[model samples]
Target: MSNRSRANRPTPDLSDANNPHAQKAQNFGPSAKRLFGILGQDKNTLIVVFIFSVLSVGLTVLGPWLLGKATNVVFEGFLSKQFPEGTTKDLVIAQLQAQGDTNQASMLENMNLVPGSGIDFDRLASILLLVLGAYLLGSIFSLIQARILNRIVQDAMNRLRIQVEEKIHRLPLSYFDSIKRGDLLSRVTNDVDNIGQSLQQTLSQAITSLLTVIGVLVMMFIISPLLALVALVSIPITIAITVVVAKRSQKLFTDQWKQTGVLNARVEETYSGHAVVKVFGHQKDVQEAFDEENDSVYKASFGAQFVSGIIMPSMMFVGNLSYVAIAVVGGLQVASGSLSIGAVQSFIQYSRQFTQPLSQLGSMANLLQSGVASAERVFELLDEKEQDPDPLTPATVAHSANRLEFKDVSFGYTEDNTLISNLNLEVRSGSTIAIVGPTGAGKTTLVNLIMRFYDINEGSLTLGNTADSAIDVRTMTRADLRSRTGMVLQDTWLFAGTIRENILYGRPDATEEDMVAAARAAYVDRFVHALPDGYDTVLDDEAVNLSVGERQLITIARAFLANPRLLILDEATSSVDTRTELLIQRAMSKLRQDRTAFVIAHRLSTIRDANLILMMEHGEIVEHGNHRELMEKQGAYWTLYNSQFQAPAQHESQTDGDHI
Candidate 1:
């Protein structure tokens, strides 16, 4: 894809019900279900959680009914006209018996009906206490449910994070080449974080809301079926609005996160190359690009929020309509003596409870969709094609034998485009071969192949002597192959840890004495003693505390500690100063003594004493000879060497002419 298309692609509507991606998500279903399946691994915890949730819902549902009983106690006490002031209990009982109102008499007796109008405060108190206790118990269960669910969610997230880390190690280097570091980091950090947060906050609420709706509906039906039907009138309408808005909002959310990824990439690029941006005075352009991405994210977010924001108010309007219908119909029922006043009150509460959860779920549509999008990205990364699967019943190769050859090797970043073709090379055991090439001459490509960072599409790379049929390198596990080789790249990488930890990275089992010896060999000890913490000094993300040359030396010390049978150094000293380069060269020479080393250097003067010189261009070795032999031929190697050695003198003469 061109940079223009990459930067300016229009935001997609991921929420369109007809959108393929959205439909695909529906087809595959939410990752939440898969996550829940992961939770199924702990069936005991799930059962306990389910029990608590049910207990909480049952207690909550019983509250309104218990409260209605209290209301009836107060209502009947105030409305009883049969008991007039100064009327005796015997007269009231006789009057009730004459009227044949046995049920009313029983209710009056149970209430401890006073001659004068008054409420049964003691009974009211008892019912109120029961209501309070039920609520308190319900809250306790709710808390337990939340805590247990949190444990399950966090444990699942932890497992997912570990899997992602392991998956990264299993992926091929080409995967990293095609993806931005920031984008990949976002998947592991931001995307996974999204999933965890959604599960923690939304998952439990979703369950509770669903239970509340069901429990409320049942209560509403029990009170008065006619009024219950009135309340049910809004269900289809609210669902209609929810589905329409959710679909549209889903698309917006996907675009929002896509823009977020772009913005992250922009920030990473600008910050990592801040010096270059300033040097070229391209700060304006960089800022403009960032603003574009930032604006896009803002717009996408606004659209998503605007659409999702409609769910609550729309549902509220529908809920209020339902409330009106229920109240009017319930009042009629009460007036006709078909329903008690207390029942009417309880039914109204249930009606509201029913709508409350629907509103909550409607609001959650946005969160659910966003979480789903993040999960899709994360799952995509997890499901990516890994480096060639480890052979079943894997085999190991012998160490300390570094005779290597590449036969008819053909490879490329993409299959259709072959960069290296029909390449053939052989190196004797324990020989130092220096590779000299210009920019984009496939220098590092060759080194990468040697390290098996990439596999060739055609032909074979073999180790051991060809005399008795060579052993194909692919037969051995990648870990075993790389363990016996040490590499020092031009771009030094050090983790944020103590200097000692970074040095010990190469050989974790190396002793302190061995670490010190390797540091001294690489000349890293010279600067280590100068730092305030000596070997304990810490490094940050950029490792800015150490100079370029200092960082390079530490990496060299790392390679030295590994003491591999084969060494690959790709422009190891290219970024250092003259004095530091000389020191690094001396260190490398010592390290390369017994190993078969492949050194890629642009400086022709540094490899004069190499056992063999392979001058490469356009993925092919154009010349092969030692210094004197190549000089005698005056070919490509000769031209490259003189260009470097004689450039300064040629510039001096040009300057002299200009002065004259």
Candidate 2:
């Protein structure tokens, strides 16, 4: 047995079929069918590649036959050297037959020889040149085939990424409620990239390998049927080995990818809240969780690779055994005068070509399976139910749609659990309504409903200047509804950008003068002027470079610049210091004039001047009136106001007198 057998040559067709980074998959049966259906978009291109691959394989198979002709020229020359000039092979065979030497006479008859003929150097040279041309042409076809396959895979992957991105925007809020952001991100990124790479590595080479098998088998049968049958002994055994290994490796790879997503989610959570982990002394717990998930990924990866790694050496061993059988059977045919030396040489080569593709095919099962699994994850994201579509004919607005009424509105994240039920409320234009409530009281949810972030399960939420002009929020497109409203949340969200850029995000087309006015109104100009870069200073991730109050001011400035008729302030002053809070209050007072505003507050001090005050509990408005009237009622609003402010105000008042 040759040490460098052609059956296991590593000449780089796409890639070496040894170990791949992405693991094999378990669901190739159903998932693989859908996966290929997507890749079939470029049917014409695939057909062109198929034709090229067949031509390449056909040329490659012809090389061995031409070389066998050269072997005949050399063997016949060696036979001619054994006899005198002018003696023919028929004369020698008749003399041997008269002398009763039947064995020698039979061998001489099979020999393709004439007495006194030396080596036909001219024919040998011609056959060698033809073999070289065949090999060269096959290589050119192979290269062209590989380039086309590369384009097909890259274009297919690009479409998949776009599909994933568009699907994200169309998904309902409820779909996000129960899913992990990090896991979904992993599918969009890691899984999609793995599938692209697998296809790139397997496609061109797989087609070529299969065609080579068919072409080589045809040549082998033409040369000798008995030897061709002997060469095929390894097929059944190799298949059994693959099936056995496949069964064990499939689940191992599946667990590996699943664990990878879990690990990524763990890393995202811990990193996003690293400061919280340190403050609460939970560093050890975070590290422990990370280690657990990391270990799970490691174990799964190890088992998958170890089980699949056995395929190569096992297949090579089977091939070597087949090689031994072919040689033995072929030698018997030559000695019995049924075959010649050159024919046996050519049949051995055909056997090698046939078995190599089969071995290659066995290795490709890993990549093919891996692609199907990754495709399944991405397909899941694409197939999730989308949010309800926008209206076909949206409601028109003659004026600002500021006044909002939630009449008999009911909503729940899920159908079985209702968070807000049969809530009815109406607000006049140019009025500021302050909603005060304890935790889980639908304070934020009510504002979200106005913005149409979540559609109500029952009843209509309408908006307009008057009752007669009122339009159902569902009748308007989300863009038309949201464009007329602005929101400032307690949790400040500032991406990595300059102060000016962040302020202009809510109103991208606003003039520089308008942005500056909004900044000054929000008290953002007070600190921004002190910085060396002024409004040009760049913020890092999460805008960590700015102070808490400064970040809040920028968001307020963004909302101010929008100039929407309906403004939602959800604990907007919670992050600011006392003096900054006072300034924001004055700015908010000016912004609320001639506009409708919804203010959800935990601190009663900020909303004392609101036109209408509402106290909500368990999604119900228990008490509502102007501030002075609610204070006189001595009900839920009065009790909550006292509990939150009376004692703290008393202490501050007592200290203020002594300091003065």
Candidate 3:
């Protein structure tokens, strides 16, 4: 079905060899089942396609039969030209029998020739016209069938695309962390697209090819059972060839697609980290890697196509042998007057029709294998377990439910590997709390739990109007909880849009005056006024046209625009210049006012004035107090704080004493 072997075809990813989806398709049976499941949703349309296909194929088979009738006319006209005038067919047979020509006598008895009649041109013309009409009607029906099939395929693919999008949204962040982004994208885009193309290319043709064969066989039998049997003999040979070639080609197809993914992944990696490659001077290494992957894909594809190409000629070989047998056998019968020459001619045509479709099916085998392999890859994604479903009815919470608490919270990313154990903490509605720790100290993990980016294995994370009136965070809808919370990370995200629109994304319905106020609060207005376009300056891809500090300020402005009840800042000023850092700190201070805030800081000095500070170590809270109180105790917080300020680890004690 897909004739352009060199053209880019769908390559379902197999880069992750251990992934369950990497397995290749083994049979058309499963592909048919999956395709039918999608088709069944529009049963009425398929019924229409089936009916038209039958009509189309029926007319196609009728063409040879009509041509046979025309052949009979011409043959009879020639014999009638030789017959004596005023002689009847009965008299001719009687005369032939008296002459001792038994075969002639038997043939004369079957002839429909009229005495003294020349060629009947009018009758011949009429029969010829009917043959043309049958073929023409068949073509019209085929066109209609094809049009409807395309529509059905397009609609089915649309539904599938939507399903993939929704599934991706429901998948947890951890799921993304576990797999290559490229592989997942292949499942979403290429795999689904290939399924649609494969179904569209193969579905109607497969149906038509099948129907044509059956209809032609019936016609052959009706004309002469002997010829039909001769043609039928090739079917076994055809099946054996198909099975042998298809089995091997399927494996090659798998290798082709697998290597395609590898090549694609290498390309993605090279381009994504081109700067790193350039700095390290590894361009030649990347080029070599790409060539290796590309060559593997090429060889695999060539092998699959070459092996599959064998089936076409193999089918033709069998069909030609059958054709020779039918011609020879029918000629003998015609000579004996047991069968007409026209019947033999029609049988020859039927033999050709039968083998042509068989050959086509052989060709479709490779395309079908590729398509089904992609379908299986996509199906695996669809079958993945979704995130925990939302509550049928969420528990209601008061408008002022901002006070946060974690009670008896014990959780881990995986079972048997607890990260936070028996954690307990509570915060008032309006408090700026800071969490400081080294890497892997459960600081960000704690923030992730609060934002519900991940559902904890065991924890009671709740928010309340007051300390005693708490409701579980899970009780509220995700949208509802997130709507009241906003976050700004150290690595800011600013999309490709105007500065105004970027800020407006946080609160779409905010007035212009309110937007400017937030922008001013985040010091975004200070930078915007300096630019020629100010608020309307369009950012480029990844907003790369702007400085990092400028991008960071825009995000902070966006968060401020939302006026969220709860705010989370991941060391907002850690990557900025000193002046920008001070500006951001002031902006955050204003934004955090009257809002419950959690600031995860890398620099301990930045959170010196926070209402409370928690020093975390190995998922445990080692110290908790105001900055001055912790410094007075000279414990874990004091030690960690002094470490950052110390000249070097070798002179840590004196630095600690001096700082204290």
Candidate 4:
């Protein structure tokens, strides 16, 4: 495809304003369903949690009921004089019996007999003990339930992180090109973290709160149906308010996350190119751009949080109103003698208990929304199609050969702009082919095709000793193809590890002796021996400790250790000094022996010894001949060589043999 066309391709929209859910339901793609599915996978744990949660609520109700009972006993014995001396023991027993029976005769028996003051103290102490026990059990089990739920959440999070990482590695390169690096990083790090936090803090709490609410309502209804109904009336109103607020904040949070990514990208870009910025005196301009993005992120985050913040207070307001209504109604019932003081107190306590969970649910709404937003981003990445599918039954090659051929191959990144069309090429075993081309002339693209980095859109690429029984490049596994192809690019990438580690990266199982031999051949051993730690010397990001020439030599050493049949050198020595270039040329000379090599170089002087040179222009071979034949033709190669060779001595001195 034309570079202009690719550069102008429409970017995908990630803005919250474009999403329908921003205006209505707070749903984030299929994340809601997928999250529920993940939670449902641990049904046993959830079920156990539900049971424990119910037990906890049951204990909570029992605590307040026991407290109310004890209060009534003390009041009757002390204030009302209902249980005076001598009859107090009987009164206590009768009270307990009445509580179990709930009949008018049992209560009358207690009122008529109880008169012992010491007995009243003993009964009150027993009731207090029961309440204490319920509280103790409730506290202990609540901790246990929380611990168990946390483990479940952590396990699920671990699984999710692994899945997301695997998906990231499997995704096509095109997908990466389409999305911002910072956004992907946010999805993996920030979004996944949000999901985990939500699970830990909000999801489990919401479930437990729900169980508590239901259990409280059941207890309240059992005590007084009228009071339970009054409490229930406020629930829907609280939920409606919470839902409306949550819906408003969901999109806002999504936008906040996206803005964070933009801000992160800006920071990453600036930090990575700090040297360039300083050289160009654009630090202020960069800072201004950063400030703009930072402001957007701050506004979005504050707005989302503000909307979410209103939910808890709104719920608390409704809960307080419900408490007042229940209090007034229950007091009237008690005063009219239809309800006991103990029963009215129990109903009021239960009403608060019911509202507590609803209050918690309201508070958890923000977390829920954030989790949904994060999940949507994560799932979107996971859902992207992979570049290559693993072969169901892979084909195997019995033997290795150096011959490579591209016959009538027509290919392009896009349909309208063809990079290579009707191109035919064949390389004999153990021969060097140098490809010379201007920028945008498909030089690197041709090498990319040969390595099967991309498959041809039309025609076949074959590799074998002969064309008759040639093996199609697509039929062979990518790993197998890559293993047999050695590549050295202009930019050398060294990971943060020991020098030996980087050298052996191409063949992890290579022996120390084999590594040293390859390093010696690539002229890397010369520099390594001078280092403080020899092969054990550690490298940092971009190997900033090493010069450009040294890094390139190390990369060459890695490729040398790979020892593949096909070698591709893409402007490999472009950034090195003249003396270092000579060393690299010597290494390349040894490396190219008996190998089918495709060398791309701008400096015509370096490839003079190549068996054949193909000069390319506008994705087509404009001239093809040996070095002398191209010079004799006085074509594109002649013009290029003359232009470069006629440059000032200083400019020529600055050039590394193969670099433009």
lDDT of 3 by residue, 422-460 (tens): 899988888989999877788888887888877777769
- Candidate 1 residue 531 Cα shift, in angstroms, is 1.3
Best by TM-score: 1
TM-score of 4: 0.89
Ten contiguous residues with the weakest lDDT in model 3:
1-10
TM-score of every model versus the real structure: 0.91, 0.89, 0.89, 0.89
Ranking of all candidate structures by their lDDT, best first: 2, 3, 1, 4
Count of steric clashes across candidates, in order = 2, 0, 0, 9
Pairs that collide, model 3: none
Error of 3 at 204 (Å): 1.2
Tell me which of candidates 3 and 4 scores higher on lDDT: 3
TM-score, prediction 2: 0.89
Tens digit of per-residue lDDT, candidate 1, span 1-660: 112112211233433566332232331265657656666776898789888998998899989988888998788778554467888666786787789876555445434455776777899999999999999999999999999999988998898899899999999876766566666777798888988887787878898999988888888888888998999999999999998898888778767766676677678878988999999999999989888879998999999889989999999999999999889998877655677778889998898888998999888877877777677777777877899976776665567778899899987767666767899988888889999977766777787787787888899988874435557878877888888899988888889998899999999999999999999988889999999999999999788999988998888899999999899887788767898788878878888787899988888888998888998877788998788899899999999999997999999999999999
How high is the CA lDDT of each candidate model? 0.82, 0.83, 0.82, 0.79
Evaluated against the true structure, the overall lDDT of model 1 is 0.82
RMSD of each: 4.7, 9.6, 6.4, 5.5
Better of 1 and 4 by lDDT: 1
What is the C-alpha lDDT profile of model 4 across 103-168, one tens digit per residue? 443444433234544237788899999988898898878877888888888888888899998897
lDDT of 2 by residue, 1-660 (tens): 111111211221111234222223236677777777777999999999999899899999999888888888898888877888898888888888899988667767877777888888988899999999999999999899899989998998998899888999888765655456666778889889988988888888789888988898888889899998898778899999989987787777666676777688788878888999999999999999899889998998898778877776788889889988999999888877778878889988888887788778778777666666677777777777898999888886755768888899987766776777888889999999999988777777787688877899999998888888998989998889888998998888888889999999989999999999999999999999898799999998678778988998999999999998999998889999998899889889899999999998888988999999889887788988998999898999888889887788989999999999
